[model samples]
Target chain A: MNYETPPLLRLCNISYSHPGTSASLLQDINFSINREHVGLIGPNGCGKTTLFQLIMGLLKPDSGTILLEGNAVTKSRDIKKLRRKLGFLFQHSDDQLFSPTVLEDVAFGPLNLGLSPDDARDVSVQTLEQLGLKDFEGRITHNLSGGEKKLVALATILAMKPQLLLLDEPSNNLDPATRERLIEILRGLDLAHIIISHDLDFLAATCTTLYTVQDGSLQRCEQKQVHSHEHIHPYGDYPHQHGT
Target chain B: MISEPFSSGSTLFHCSDARVKVIGGTVLSLVLATTTSFAVAMIGFLFTSLLLLISRPSPGLILKRIATVNIFTLFLLFSLPLTYGGADIVQLQYFQISLDGMRIACLIAIKTNGILFCFLALLATSSTVSLGHALERLRLPRKLVFLLLFSYRQLFVIHQEYLRLHRAAQLRAFTPSNSLHTYRTYSHLFGMTLVKSWNRAERVHQAMILRGFDGRLIPLKQPQLRKSDYLLLASLLLISLILAGFSLNNPV
Candidate 1:
């Protein structure tokens, strides 16, 4: 594909495994992405989420170069700077919304970024409003429903105004309406994003391209191939209603 | 899992500034700790009861908090009298309990329960975010406050994670048994929990770092103390002084 802008994120020769384990979880992962929405689909334990941790510098690849906007992310200091440009949404919203109240949680990033408390709060409020969560400001985070928690978690990241978003299972446990809302929200964002989800229809609605993880390697997936794959849902027949 | 369940109430205690509550509660706990007389402890108990009556917290929540604290307090009942080895206050054919030990134990229990009830009425009545803000306002170390918030958030998450794993095991026909297999299974479960916990912590740290979080956590709001807050603080201090005077005069 031809592009006018340089890739927002670039990974080269990335490989990693848990210490003392011989099997590599991710091997020779070469990838680059820009502002276009991308989807990552893979079976459980196929190193999809591990790739995200690597990009965020939570886990380091044994040998590789990761560049964010052309800056190296090998050192802790460099990772610190690179992270601000990227937002990672964990597979579990419970892991992300650590602050007591939705407003506090959303403001956490801005506060850490050295914005004054008032400014941080303003940004949080705006972000929550953008996500249609204006009434959740004083609500305790844990009291939120699963879908609400997901939106709040995303709001916390969006409050940072990141250049790129790394979303893992963004549609994991949402009701159909919430999933539709999430799809619309994802579609509306102007920033680049790499979303990992098993919900192919949801991904089809929001993502411009798709990649499949197989045996520790990422391969570009054809649109037609994605629809043809036979998969079984453990929770009865897949209930997702796809747009024609 | 302390519930800030009463935070939304329109009660006077709920509306009072968190900083005032924090400072007043600390001072009161200090007084409770220093009281050398049972009379002072009794007054502290009375104060706790009054606070409880006004706050009007769920009786079940209060009982739960007391039950949690009693786990540690119960140890004193067994160890205090035997360890002190003083003059026997209660003599029996098989064993004797020491008077000084008995006195110390009772005093410690009163002090603990008094402080705990005070905490429930003051600190627990406000949201944790407000409590964290109150700590920041009081100029407590920012890193310490950050750690406090981090732990508070993770406590429930870690607990729920463990419960989920336990439930998964139960679904797989696993049952608690006094056997090596059971011990090994539990050990593995604990080890997995620790690994998952550490991984979760690392991810949370990364997420925080992404938002420009340095080592210090900045307070999101700085609520101002109102006139009512000062009034409440003054009343609390005055009562504390009167209680101290009575305890000083009427020694146990």
Candidate 2:
């Protein structure tokens, strides 16, 4: 007998539309990921977030099948099981962090997973230490700077020890130094992740596979294709790369 | 901005366990509120004032807070003596002043100041999150604790949203004045803020579910009450009981 492990995540024939809308935002989308760092890039409001919501089971797809580790995620219990192995980081760190303190926020997921208070706290401390946030345990969540909040938000997910992470706009609104630090952290992580960002350079530095959502479909793009291009400006014609 | 200026100190009140402070503060406030004896109220006021001093709050801020509370008491002092009816009446220029009314208002003012001082000394020393956790440990309703924690977290977000909207209005050269246009613009700004907050709440709820959040929010670190915390609680309770006893023996 021959058998192989299935993909980490699989979406087959997925389609979704907003309520009361006739046009589908995402249509006939089929994608799969397996133990590889992936990057997803697209324009604003092109259903990138909607696709993530479907994957996280926040919104039910109009027509589709989502498989996590070869198990179909249809029922609520199945979705809960899938969530145990999948971590979704929101685009807005403010929305992702609801706890008043850093340690509490990081420990939230572990506590929800039925870990004891001591074990969850230990996990939270270790996660924060891994992220170079050792002294941030007692920091107020609302008082953190933008970059610090983003890193703390990532720690909250990392504490859960999920198999795959889905990070939405991880590099949004970060300063140059903090963005560089984030890139290094993402590259150092051993688990697989699908990062959604508008920063092409960030994607190139962190992801091994690149995908773009356009025209309601997911398409693979070559790294070589993301090169400098000439464009006409009001002042003059100039060559510039994306995300300059 | 809602600032917790007193929350970052290293005084005894700050170092004590939040649960101890919460219980002590609540008990003291209850005792003071129920007491009608002038002597008991004065003693409680002095005790709370000493506690506030030991907490080592900035002198200026503490004075400002006391001043704000006293403003309302000043109004009571001026109005109560003239309006309240009693046997001991004194004739003013155009009204009768009741000595009993004056006594009652003075008692209320003293109790109010005492409670305020107690709250500032004990409760304000801990951050709101710690207070919520302390309340949870004290067997308060889980939903109420959640509501307090979540609302405290979202207050900053909502405040920031409102500031952004106000900034946008300023960029458009909108100015406030006694005019219908200004009122309309202010209403629109408030409406937009509410709508944005509603949307953000939905997104935050989704994020919570994605993290496998069940109905309960478990606190990670449960602070143990140390010997000092126990000592402080015992002292406060003793003071409260003594004051209650004195008030019962010498009722107004």
Candidate 3:
């Protein structure tokens, strides 16, 4: 990594509120990501996903600048450039994998990058093979098993060969075996990614840095502080560790 | 779960190019629909039936589908003879049945069945994705094809969402009945499903943009038309031309 180069992504004083609402969903979110795996966690409705949407230009920030590779993203063209460098894996695999077949869905990003159909297919095939899904090319997207659909959805993003990935709940609905496979794949990837997941174990295994969004603010959480401890619930005398 | 059961096969129709099948199916159906002569209609029906047989769909499924279509025609069969006025009439005690009306109804039933069999043999043998690509290649509007392909893809998602909502309601002891409460609950369930689907659509759109999707959906593979496909197309056109000639020569 060149020290002279700027961070891969930078956000400055970012704030956002839903239209027609008084309260802000996010406020003064400042962060920068280098070539490193980052994990973002928050309680439900804490604006973690909204932060990602702002980064990806899906939703504009009310006040702030989003920088991609040292350039300010202030226009549609700049957003497009940012998008070219960033691949966002949606929370639901069903939403991400819209094409009929696995190959088509995987090829979609490459084709949009202006590759010819044959070349796009070649890249899609290579991406699938890299992810151990060589035989899934002809499988219908909707008919795929939950685990298979998740892998294929990841493949769709990976086919674009982005410099960074924004993954939202990649391991949400996976079985144990599949989740293990996902962890292995994520650990093996060389590209930087920011994963938003409630599964702390999943984040601990795959991400180098963890961040938490609370009360419309983003703060870094230390890795050493992510240990499980016995705790009692208000409704029961039994004590158990979280995520047991 | 929704599925395209007929899309997987190795028969001639299954192996044929989707564009050819689309063209052949359209021409044959148009011919069958427009023809008025019984002779042409019967020949077209036999031809489509033979195509259906060659495609090798499950006999039980084919019978069920044909029966479903014929059920509607059965209404026509019963009512047309009584309602249609003609010189040639069969007198019953309280009503008169027109022979021409009966003939025309039978012709329509034959034509409808012929078209149905033709589509099942051709269109259903290929996956809807390939069919959408074929339509695009045939110079259909790109937006229309996109609409068709997207709608087909989203139908299952929307259905699953609806089922999940319905299951949640069921878990809450909400039983659907012929009552205002049931109706209200059902409407709320449907409305929630729509809202969820709308949000999912927005997320999907964002995902697409994040992955650099432009306006066009380019297909990865462009299926090539082979000799067999050309032969199929030629034979279908020849059959259609023959049926058209028979109809023109012997008008109803």
Candidate 2, A145-237: lDDT as tens digits: 999999999999999999899999999999998998898898899989999999988988888899899989999897556345666656455
Ten contiguous residues minimizing lDDT sum, candidate 1 chain A: A224-233
Q: Which CAPRI quality tier does the interface of model 3 achieve?
A: medium
lDDT tens digits, residue span B60-155, model 2: 998999899999999999899988988999998898999999998899899999999999999999988789989999999999998998888788
Question: Residue B84 of candidate 3: its Cα lDDT?
Answer: 90
Candidate 3: residue B208 Cα off by (Å):
2.3
TM-score of chain A of 1: 0.91
Clashes of 3: 0
Local distance difference test, candidate 1: 0.85
What's the best-to-worst order under DockQ? 2, 3, 1
lDDT of each: 0.85, 0.90, 0.89
* Model no. 3, DockQ: 0.67
For model 3, give the TM-score of chain B. 0.97
Judge the docking of candidate 2 as incorrect, acceptable, medium or high: medium
Candidate 1 scores a C-alpha RMSD against the true structure in Å of: 5.0
Please give the interface root mean square deviation for model 1, in Å: 1.7
Better model by lDDT, 1 or 3? 3
**Alpha carbon deviation, residue B108, candidate 1 (Å):** 6.1
Q: For all the candidates, what are their Cα RMSDs to the real structure?
A: 5.0, 3.4, 3.6
What's the TM for chain B in candidate 2?
A: 0.95
